[model samples]
Target: MWIRALQAVLDRGIRQGRLHVRFPDGRMGSYGPGAGTGPEAQLMITDPALPRRILLNPQMALGEGYMDGGLSFPSDDDLRGFLQIAARSAQSGRLPLPMRLAHGLRVRTKGLMQWNTLHLARRRVQHHYDIPDAFYALFMEEDLQYTCAYFRDDAMTLEAAQAAKMAHIAAKLCLRPGLRVLDIGCGWGGLALYLARAHGVHVTGITLSQVQLEAARSRAAAMGLSDRVAFRLQDYRHVPDRFDRVVSVGMMEHVGVPQYQAYFDKIHGVLAEDGVGLIHFIGRHTPPRVLSPWFQKYIFPGGYAPAFSEVIPRVERAGLVVADLEVWRGHYERTLRHWQQRFRANEPRVRDMFDDRFVRMWWYYLIAAEVSFTDMGMVLFQMQIARRSDAVPRVREYLYPAPGDDQRPSDTA
Candidate 1:
């Protein structure tokens, strides 16, 4: 029964790419090449229990089994390629109705177990970000940007791509000297310090992770910007001042559906009348029904990636205008490719930090994230928001510096 169920899932899910599975005792089967040709993937399941596991829940079993060594890919990177087919099969709506309905009912019938309440939020943030700095240093660029990096060109290095991302945000913001900027969910203070140095903006960065708080503060002091930028280990609700600009990059995803109204309301209360805000986050094409069970259990405890339709209404309800929104495709796919490459290259070092289970989980995390953008409906959202309709220029031309305009760093003091 389990073998038939596994084969049936592959037959329906894979339409374009080839997926071959080798069961124990020398039995083998293949799917795809019946539609179009692209990449082929092979999986070897050494443990007999895995077929039953995959039959119960293919989505969660693939992740859990891979971490447990029950499932094996040809290579570390091959799992990423294989997930591409799986994600496409899942998202393409080509599956039989019963399969779709069964999965839909599963997600729809359940409620999220984790909520980003103050205590839970702190714990969640710490669970993910409090890994030793050396672990992150192994994969991240010099800037240690844990979020998405903007790729200007295919040839740009990770370090260069990350720097361009900061510049891109700065461009959209139209920052001028001495503007007070509030950075919600600031990761390691990278963006905050960049804004202060590049635009002379005074930045107050708030985060829930003590690990990030101390690191960001240490970096600011080392760079002699102790007075210019501040990092606090606090929640967004406790931030005490209104700012001329607000930015929450890669952070709003954690503001679960339950907190959407309050999240935007806090931003609304603290934004200056003429101030504007930008939020960069991972979002889905459809309304998010619930968190991924494996993701919720292993990586982020209380995270929810809002859908376009789900969030805009809440932002509008907060009395903020959605001035402009940009959907970034392919960029995050490229970003994750780099991270995955780095991770696989340094897997030995990471294994030294944690057991093989932890390493496997991180590998799965990187591959899953990369393939989500590449194959699933996951995309990045950079939303430009403001209080008034006329706060920003009528056109995007102003966002681009006028010829010979001084976008350069100066005594912005």
Candidate 2:
């Protein structure tokens, strides 16, 4: 029955023009069973070895299979998208049994997983952020903002969404002229330069990657905002001065479970009296017993998304009041899709630096991420936090159009 169901879906995908199997000679055909019989299909079809290769060495095999002229796709992105959908559905009920057992054992001996150690954390940070600046620049916008973007409307381009994100974050922080703003894990200094150049705020950005720090500094100098915005190659724990506002975007995932409290404490310690801190993060609906093995091994090694229950307690413990919480779930799906599109458009430039496997791996990661957001209804949260004694303000509110708004489209300039 399950096999029949799978075949039916595959047929539907091909019929709908969503999946097209490609032959070695570069001719595309429908993905039906008999479509593999033609002479053109000799490269990829009728060989048990092909499927075995793909399944056993998932990342490397798939990459080599595509590159060695053994397999092809009408659109690599769409092929992976459909494959992810099918895999997730097939594994929905049955695969979680072993996952549950593994999670239970990990939870039983929590400390046995050395993910929280400083060495491991540093290694994880380096593994993801240490990718060449030029490689990231291939797809990321000129500003090089690496987090989820806030779109004022669906018609808004990625550039506009990124600008909106910076403006929104700055407004939330209420940056005034000459006030010091601290950006934790600042990527490429987009927000820092935005705050300094647009809002006349003095910004200090910290990052673990030397590549990011140098790129940010050069960008700041080019923009003539070097004096107002500074990028430091340092960790958040070692930041020396207090600031009027603190903003950490997409950095919380790296803060392991055991270090959550300490992370918050350090942020709280550096924030001035009545200061505001805006934390933007991708959150999970429920706490996972363990990080996904694939993500831990391939993508972000020490990263874990936190549930609201886990986050709120830490904020309260750090003596901060959450004055406002805004959830932007669908916006992230659009943001990631935009990124995937940009990456695809620049594939030639990217392939020059990285191999086919790395490219496929990243594409799979992004598409799978998009599917996860759609399936689980996960959220992106931007919380306005302040010292406990600071009174919450009822400022005049401004609401933007929702995800489907037609006014904004295309993230390009």
Instruction: Write down the RMSD of all candidates, one decimal each.
Output: 2.4, 7.3
Candidate lDDT (C-alpha), each: 0.83, 0.69
lDDT at 16 for candidate 2?
19
lDDT of 1: 0.83
Question: Which candidate wins on TM-score?
Answer: 1
Model 1 Cα shift for residue 306 (angstroms): 2.0
Question: Which candidate ranks first by lDDT, i.e. highest?
Answer: 1
Clashing pairs in 1: none
Model 2 Cα lDDT, one tens digit per residue, 61-134 = 44455444455544555555454443443334432244346546755554344346666766778899888888
Candidate 2 steric clashes: 8
The count of backbone overlaps in candidate 1 is 0
What TM-score, over all chains together, does every model reach? 0.93, 0.78
Please report how far candidate 2 places residue 250 from its true position, in Å: 0.9
User: Stretches of candidate 1 above 4 Å error?
Assistant: 92-102, 109-111, 287-290, 402-413
